[model samples]
Target chain A: MFGRKGKKGNYAYTVARVKAKKSQLMGDDAYQKMLMMSLPEISRFISETGYSKEITSMTGKFTGINLIEHATYANMASVFTSILDSATGELKDTLAADLERWDIWNLKIILRGKSFGIDLDSIREDLVPAGVLDAEDLEKLMSLDVDDDIIANYGRMTGVSIPQSVVAEYKAQGNLAPIEDFLDKHHFERLLATIDSRSRPTRLYQEFIRKIIDTINLETILKLKLEGIHGEPVMKYIISGGKDIDKKLATQLANAETIAEAENDLAQLDMYEFIKDALGKDTHSLKDIVAGLRRYKMKEASTFSHLYPLSIIPIIDYMLHKENEVNNIRIVARGIDAGLDKEIIKGLLVI
Target chain B: MAADLGMIMIGAGIAVGLTGLGAGLAEKDVGAAAVGAITEDVGLFGKAMVLMVLPETIVIFGLVIAILGVFVLPNM
Candidate 1:
């Protein structure tokens, strides 16, 4: 992967562009101001910033929370698409791989909507067109009638293996969890397959993916523990390829007697030092812990980006920051629409 | 004696040329990032310019050595 051609790829140019874009993301100050605004005021606030074009154009069609949410998603999709478009060679492939999470997200949305018989238009509205799949492919996937047809279309579009067993399990359970787990596993498998551990950039990418898997495992284990589920059953939901929480530790954590025990088990891992406070807090809710983990990961990504300025880490950092901004604004807009208190909404934002 | 002078000249040429190449290589990424930073906020132009030219010092040092080899050191 570190051949002459790979070396010649536009690392300097792409990283520079991404760094600039990163600076333009919403700061904590902006989010603080947004927490006090009503939905319309929030919309106006966004319109005066980087999201002006999207907010202005979407204002005619959508209003209130929907307007802000849709505009945010649209702007996110466009920006990410442009980033993908701007990249080439190995960088492009790495970015495309990273962005495939959006496709997975879109698929999950469709699957959930379909199972519940929600309208396709509503599902489409939630979709972010930021991955390898274009609008046409998503439209086709959305219009497909049967589960088999949808799975086939998804497999074809994403090249991710959707095993028949997952479908069978979904049918038997009447829940989307099986299918979602399968997709998550498949995504990580495909991601790990493409990345060469020998290359610095890909190695960093791999490390990031492993951390995500570890975080997901920790979250799942904690949630299941809270639900009174335990033993080997919980291990089934734990995705593989985690850096810190290997299969043995995952099983141990899953089998821990209580959430505190699970926290102790996690404390033995490398991330313990970083997450000690969050895990140690007696009053910390599951949601707060999960959000704390995400924040920690984002901070880690920022460090990696600074350390390796020309690597894929900076681009990933930029994308994560952008995603956080989008999610934060959505929380504020929706919180205002639902008449939630400013402090509550502010607490929900990751910033 | 003429051959010795030619070899010294070649040594000086290599020093300047390779150092210039090294400086160029270092400057490439810095320049790109600077341009990107400037694109986001024009206020960074001065800072970017300073950073973008920082690697040129390597080339300047190389040139000084080359000058010494060619003019001053040879006379000594």
Candidate 2:
């Protein structure tokens, strides 16, 4: 019912409805209870919970974690497409353009799979299967014997200049970083692009993205430190638009006595406070921290929509929030397969 | 007669009252969101309370105009 004038309500309403569903996502208590159940029990639990319809329809064909993983992917894609279908105005266009980043991700994963000769079916399973790129287009690209345009496609999709620069790098190196870089550049640029300056509604949205970019930069820097990659090279990989985590600053942090101290330094940056809240001094596990950060990004968007009911903010918010819930379910399913403790797996969840 | 000024005063009062309506409209979303977050976790009660009430600033702005309209404007 809420949208900018003359624009269709479908996208915004769907966004709101999906947000209500997102609120129903499993909490800590639910995860604790889930740990006490078996795979079949977990499947039943999901069916009784949110994925009930998908589970029942796909029943007898799949079982256990496999069933939930596939169902979660399907439900997530269905929800996302519904949002896409709901688009009405420039907001619709913007959401679609932003969503193209997923295709960039899919292309990178496909190309990487090829470089390693991983099976096509396996790689396909990893993709979101939703977004601007059509299934036929992906299938066509996925079948290319040569590497997927994984890099140039991002440049084209995001309207960035990197794909051309990376084309030669792709051919000579056969590494996926070039295309991946284009996607990275595209993501930050799109987030900062055409920010609705007049709308008070858009300010928090901007700050929210700044935090995501800043965290990604922090994660990259941390990875570099652990990998022992020194300043210049790691600096080259640093994505722009982050509050401050560029090479010189990162190098300064790298020289710190420990990761904790480095993070403390980052926390001192006014813009980098989100990182501190999501992660603390060397206490949380890396996987948990990353997942938490990812979830945090989605939740921040959700929070935005709630505060400012106008604009396309809520739609994007629901999109990310729903994606994380799907990811969490997949993680729980996978963890169960590996026979890990329920508490440990739950601990890793961002919820 | 100065009766025209009385009409102007009433119109101003109505507009001033609307500021409260606008403030309440804004709080509708803020309050819902804060409670949503709180329902997810009881520990969030404190932070959510602060955030939910944060938008009360709008009402305070409205109230300032309201008081000025009564005491200050009447004297003027």
DockQ of each: 0.56, 0.05
Query: What tens digits encode model 1's per-residue C-alpha lDDT throughout A1-351?
Result: 325435445677778888878877889999889877778898899988889989889888888877888888889999899878877778788788888999999888888888889997678778898987777888998898787898888888888768888889988998889989888887888888878788776788788879878988888887888788999889889889999899999888988868777776776776566557766777647767777777877887898887767788888888888988998888888888898988988878886
DockQ-based CAPRI category assigned to the predicted complex of candidate 2: incorrect
iRMSD in angstroms, per model: 1.5, 6.0
lDDT of 1 at A117: 94
User: What would the DockQ be for model 2?
Assistant: 0.05
What is the docking quality class of candidate 1? medium
By DockQ, the best candidate is 1
| 10 residues in a row with least lDDT, candidate 2 chain B | B32-41
User: Highest TM-score, which number?
Assistant: 1
Candidate 2, residues A175-273, lDDT tens digits: the string is: 767667756776778767856655575576666666667667767766666666555666666777765555567677756644665776776764354
**Candidate 1: misplaced stretches above 4 Å?**
A1-8, A270-284, B1-12, B69-76
